[model samples]
Target: MDLDLAQVRAFVLAAEESHFGRAAEALSISQQALSKRIARLEAGLGTALFRRTGHGVEPTGAGDRFLEPARRALAAADRAVAAALDERRPPRVDVWGHLYAPMRTLAQVAAGSGAPPLELGHGRDLPSVAAALLRGDIDAAFGRVHPPLPAGLTHRLVRLEPVDAVLSADHPLADEPALRPGQLRDSVLWTPAALHRLDFLHRFAERFGIRHHAEGTNLGLDGFLADVAADPRRFSLMPADVPLPDDPGIRSVPLVEPTPLYAWSLLWCGGNPRVDALLGALAAEAGRSRWLEYDPAEDWLPEPAGEPA
Candidate 1:
């Protein structure tokens, strides 16, 4: 019996996510379709692969045994496809957290004469970027890498950017030279999306005892900054290097006495030569720009999965 790669892929994603709904979303397929593919995969193997739990599904003994091999098989297939494609085609690189403008760093890297040609794209977040990487839709992605990264992906931390608190010029604290996280405790923490989705911001607020939280629709960075500028009680954190809008009403004050640092990492599946070239370029640029500097005693960063690269 032969296995359909599509069915195998669906089974792999389901196993990784534990929840069929989330797996389906990652694969950009309907839950029913994912279920059908998984069922067919199980039938072809003549064994049950998953057992349902109250929360979702868990791989059975057979599935746990098959997991590593399935991953290797997919990697092999991706490599074969890459070999047949036009070698001159630039590697596709995607970015998340567009509000922070990850492209600024990418552009800096690409400006070097030794950098490889790259095709750029945008992803909604880490999950979507992971899905695209596993599918071989993109060669690499740049973003904040959190724990339990998707099964086949690897990452290298590239930069640690200082964060600043942006507020309306008229706010009570706007005149301060610099503010500590504690100073903002009584103010509302405004965000571009819900608190749950913005992990870094959520943790920042929690760590600082900033009790009040508010969210606004993401209407581009300018609009988001405008919203923060419009409310005296609202304040938001932004990467210090990100250029603010020209509006005079916005005041971007540095967060000192433990400046919050946003971590940027490069993620990839590991077989592409172009990925290696890009990584080299990024490493060189990062070193020259002092992009990886961090001092835990004087800076704030969320608990990371691994040491910075």
Candidate 2:
């Protein structure tokens, strides 16, 4: 049956006070109005809820029975409203990346003017991470992107790094100030090719005339260093900002003369918070670092037949 919450509240307060005047004062309504609300509630339930006495009033058996359930209903209503409001509150946007040097740089850039709250998701590579971003499971991801970025999903160039070589310690050119491209022609570059979709890495190997060994992703860092130390003819390319292993068996040197860049970007689907604003801040912040940057307008993807313009 239809029942007013106000009537229920008036009944409860009046029953508790046992005095119509005191209950009215507590409810900020006139004595007549309080009496009328309680009367209406009692009539709806077809029972006498209170009996007038010299002390003012007292609950009937029916009123006492109704009091506990009425209080519970009001408490339930309060909880329902609070839960509804909580559902309407804004969502927390997330920023995700591996904890590499470039990712650290991205964190600084993204914290612009202390804006939209960020949840940092970490230690994942691009393929799985990109899938999550596209599925709206994550807000944004930071990593090097492969070609054919899906429609409606775009990238902002955040950090750019030159390719550095991990060379055998005994290699003749390892002592040079930096490596020139001409010396790279006869070398073979080995990579964790099976672990990622790095089209750019393969293309860079082709453009620089270096043979590439598409090794399986089973090697650990120590194992990789051992492989490098074991061969004078094999070298590996890594992002310049990424830390190299400290080993006397190898030398880490930047590649020069049309230096290949490893570009990282923020990839997102439509309508995300702080993406454009954060990208702008990143551009300004990166200028202070040694890494070169692409214009914010240029998509992170490479230009065909050449470097990003």
Q: Each prediction's TM-score against the native? A: 0.82, 0.57
lDDT of 1 by residue, 42-153 (tens): 9999999999999999999999998867875776687787688845788899989847889998999999868898999999988888877876778899988887786678
For model 2, the superposed segments whose C-alpha errors exceed 4 Å read 1-102, 107-117, 122-127, 212-223, 274-277, 290-309
Residue lDDT tens for model 2, 12-99: 7787789999989998999999889988888889999999999899999998787766755654454456466664333223443322
Instruction: Provide C-alpha RMSD values for all models, in order.
Output: 4.6, 19.3
Error of 2 at 291 (Å): 4.6
Model 2 is weakest, by summed lDDT over 10 consecutive residues, at 300-309
Screening candidate 1 with a backbone cut-off below 3 angstroms (N, C-alpha, C), the clashing residue pairs are: none
Could you tell me which 10 consecutive residues in candidate 1 have the lowest summed lDDT?
300-309
Instruction: Give the whole-model CA lDDT for all candidates, comma-separated.
Output: 0.87, 0.64
In model 2, pairs of residues that clash are none
Tell how far residue 304 is off in model 2, in angstroms. 6.5
